[model samples]
Target: MADHGNDPVVVIGLGRFGSSLALELARRGTEVLAIDSRPKIVQSMAGRLTHVVTADSTDLEALRQLGVPDFYRAVVAIGTDLEASILTTSLLVELEVDDIWAKAVSREHGRILQRVGAHHVILPEHDMGERVAHLLNGRMFDYMEVDENYALVKTRPPREYIGIPLGESNLRRKYGVTVVCVKGQDEEFTYAGAETVLAYGDVIVIAGKIDQVERFAELP
Candidate 1:
């Protein structure tokens, strides 16, 4: 959970995905307002979100009355109705919301949302499948895209490098990767200027070009 209490977030659907996102954001202490066309869904999620509203998200007038634009970010989570999802997203952009995230059922739907000014579009099922695949592979712990050419990655230490000293490894010269942080169970993480020795079970946070990082992972 990320702290977002100072950031107002609006979730414009109360379906399973929308409601789950709203609850997670609320748990993170964000000021979250959830809306749905279904009164039953709104009623069920009332206790979990900071605020809940029952209204058709496609209605621009209804959205305006709810001060949707005042939110720092908005999520269009209407899954089944493509028209309603597009309309809600468009209305949010027109109101000049700072950021907007849309859920797409397919590649075409994702592209349509992107053209309409959505800051991001998510294909939940596709993303989930990829995540599960990563977990099964067990080589990469997580991946963070830093830019077009670079990424920050978390991975287990290579077997041959498990007992090496940070200063002696010369990972930058050998693999072109820079260790950003080293985490050990017994001590706090060392960032950049770490003078610690690597040990088994320690997670390494490295930043570099994607190819170089992957090369490092391939080391025995």
Candidate 2:
């Protein structure tokens, strides 16, 4: 297990994503260093994180003073500030930060971040819009992206699969997907297995490559 309690995570720009990330890490026993240019934002998070500093992350010297590069992980959660975001990410790379997570405002911004050495770039609006569209279309009950090509999805067991044991369905052999669990209509869950029977109203939790997972979701 990774010891999140020891290695601290540094979060920059205390906007919606940054503040939420810091608080959640702290809540789960991970030490967090939260930084922002805004005094109000830093002050708001005081005592909530291991340390909160009001400093300009884009300034190399300011980041050096905060020991930002010492952290194995750094998050650039700047809000709608493309220049600042890129500058901060560049500094992190220059300092050899291992994992850099950045938020991009647009496709171009994302490309730039990648070029500048951001290990992970997230476009929240674009990703969320696609997620909502999938759920609204009714084919998928819920969706989560594990990576560019992998995903974990929850959808009702295909109508024809209900009342049959998964062992006989040959789902894994046919679709290359695995059912991790089955959510019963009563809201309880059980570990899925070959012998476990699929029931009406059961939400199947399947994980695999996106294409396989979606194909399994459409199972009849």
Best prediction by TM-score: 2
TM-score of 2: 0.87
Q: Global lDDT of each model?
A: 0.82, 0.86
Which candidate leads in lDDT?
2
Clashes of each: 0, 0
CA deviation > 4 Å runs, candidate 1: 1-5, 145-149, 192-194
Q: For residues 41-115, what per-residue lDDT tens digits would candidate 1 score against the true structure?
A: 888877777689899887888988999978878999999999999988989999999789999999899999999
Which window of ten consecutive residues has the lowest lDDT sum in model 2?
A: 1-10
Model 1: pairs clashing at backbone N, Cα or C within 3 Å: none
Residue-level lDDT tens digits of model 2 in 110-152: 9999999999998988899978976786568889988888888
What value does the lDDT take at residue 5 in candidate 1? 45
Q: Where is model 2 more than 4 Å wrong at Cα? A: 1-6, 172-177, 208-212, 215-220
